[model samples]
Target: MLPSLLLLFLSIPLTTVTAASAAPRCTTSTPIKTYQKCMNLPTQGASLAWTYHPHNATLDLAFSGTFISPSGWVAWGLNPDSPAMTGTRALVAFSDPSSGGLLLLPFILDPGVKLQRSPLVSRPLDLPLLSSSAMLRSDSSVRDGAGLHIFATLRLSPNRTRINHVWNHGLYVQGYSPTIHPTSPSDLASRATIDVLSKATEMGPAVPSWFRTAHGVLNAASWGFLLPVGVTVARYLRQCTSVRPTWFYGHAAVQIVGFLLGTVGFSMGIIMGRASPGVTYTLHRGLGVAAFVTGGLQAAALLFRPKTTNRYRKYWKSYHHFVGYGCVVLGVVNVFQGFEVMGLGGSYWKLGYCLALSTLIGVCVALEANAWVVFCRRAEEEKVRREGRVEEHQVVKASIGI
Candidate 1:
């Protein structure tokens, strides 16, 4: 995992590449009705142009993609519903290493995820590939390697006057890694919208992109880092005699703030899930729930804190330690899972969290060492004082006897 992240960060700074048509290559002699848009990406970028012929019920799509490596896969697809991979009808193209010819196939993202595994098996699809309907051209616009130009003419339903508002996304697999398939998790990372001859203007994703960003940042900082910081204060700083009750108050304050932020972040995620019908992150959701529940338990425990003289004080301490640490671990793990779910596993968000967590661990280690040293010194002083008292008692007994 670490190596993959290093590789991703090393390769993510993308370069701009253009695939200019030498001349106007509209499908028809007359001015073609066309729509064009571009989406910038981390590894590469894509520009899509489509022409609609209402009379013939045909849609001509040209997808030009920049490539970081020459050998691998690139796909452009229309998802009938949301912009997720599981429901997309994709036109997949890859350079066959053995045959040295570009092979194009029509694939459907199925209900099951097995199709996303390596050695991608041919699957049944709703859209049939028209005879000689696919075309591939070399684009020398990219400096690192040649780009891929994929063009296809697809048939639309009869009597359909306007296109439905649908999601369009693209994917690229770098090099020929056997484990990586077209429908793999990483392939779902890049996407863009396509509006072609739709009467209702698309409003955009169910949850705005900015909202998702906020959700990730808030939860990761609160649950992942700040909560742990509060735990550290209660564990280590509370022992400092000089600080007295300040550490207790500080711990309570930080924990309260972290819980509030985490609650807001968790709510955003729930809203986002409702906004997109077919898209779901099951593991991320589960982990998030577990963290939230345990965190709530810890907070509620504060209300029933046992007094130091209470017979159940040991039980309360045990419960607090177990739940608090468990919650912290889950929160941190879920944050990483959220990053992957958002296609940001290698992004700076993950990097920043890692750096913060690392700093916290360093602080804990330093403080623990100082605490142990102070404890040892106090123990030594107490032992010496006891020895002195015993000597003085012995001397007084000897003088009285004389």
Candidate 2:
């Protein structure tokens, strides 16, 4: 009976050991109470100072601090002899701006557990940071043991305004001390930031990005379609001697095409800008309006009777030039603006378009100016020849006594 009892006891010990080995080292995390004591071990050999990242970033303050290392590396003073070192609870502190209190964010270390949060639409976040990402901040990482020891640098985002709205924010962590559910582990970290800025609920620009992209493109396209019509009119004004039927046909065809295209493009741009309100979107709107008004006026000019005199034609030419150039300029400006809002990156598109336009404009202006100069020179020469012919005829008649 005594041998049987001894064998049962020995078997019990083996089963317990197996169960313990299979179980995780850490799984549950406890929150740090403000009243809880933070233990600091005597540093004999600590890892380099544990890097400190602030919860809220302030001007004139550095985002840094010290921490304990599990290895007792030299960075922080290590005392392997301390019970806290073995137990894993030490200190996580931030400096209090007033009176220099060591504000501690404490945690009982755990591993692989996470605390998730949904963004609050109505409540204001309690943070001094100007980053919108603070909405997703969690205290899961308050505990440790995921083998990630990062020197986090939490700072305010530089983006201030979106659709005249201000965004406030701070750091978000996963597996943070679960404020809502306390039994979760502590090894979670959020790589994606939440919010730094937001637009007002009533703003037109409060629409989503995909919607804005579609709309803005349409507006821009509408503006562009009108361009070819103006270009044709400009060419005719410069080259046509008589306003022939073909000239009017060419103008009418181009106008029809331009208006159709511009309308589609304009509608799209409005939709897109309303969807994504930003600096680029503002420009897109302004340029779109300008294109529409100028194009409308140019088309309307057809209703007015132009004078028959050559000089009056020149006068009409000035109006045509103004409207044509205005439409062209607006179309071109919006194209670049669209590309910018799309975040197409770098000066790649801008540079290419600039070089092409500059070359084309330069060639046209030079040729037009040369043509005018030659025409004036020819007129002067012809005037001199006609006068000389009259003078010669008069002299010949006098000598013949006729």
For TM-score, the strongest prediction is: 1
Local accuracy by lDDT, each model = 0.66, 0.41
For model 1, residues 22-99, the per-residue Cα lDDT tens digits are 222333211222454222222134545566667877776666654444554666666656555666777666665556
Q: What is the lDDT of candidate 1?
A: 0.66
- Alpha-carbon runs more than 4 Å astray in model 1: 1-104, 108-168, 171-205, 396-402
Clashes of 2: 37
Best by lDDT: 1
Tens digits of per-residue lDDT for model 2 on 1-402?
989966875676577566544533321122211211111111111111111222432221111112222211101011112211121222233223343332334333222212223421122223332321100013222222212111212233344221111111122222222122211111010001112222122223222223344444444444544465447455644454666656666766766677667777677666544433222335766877887888788778867738766467877778977887888778777777766655543556556655656665676677678768878988999999999999999999999998
What TM-score do all the candidates reach, one by one? Answer: 0.59, 0.43
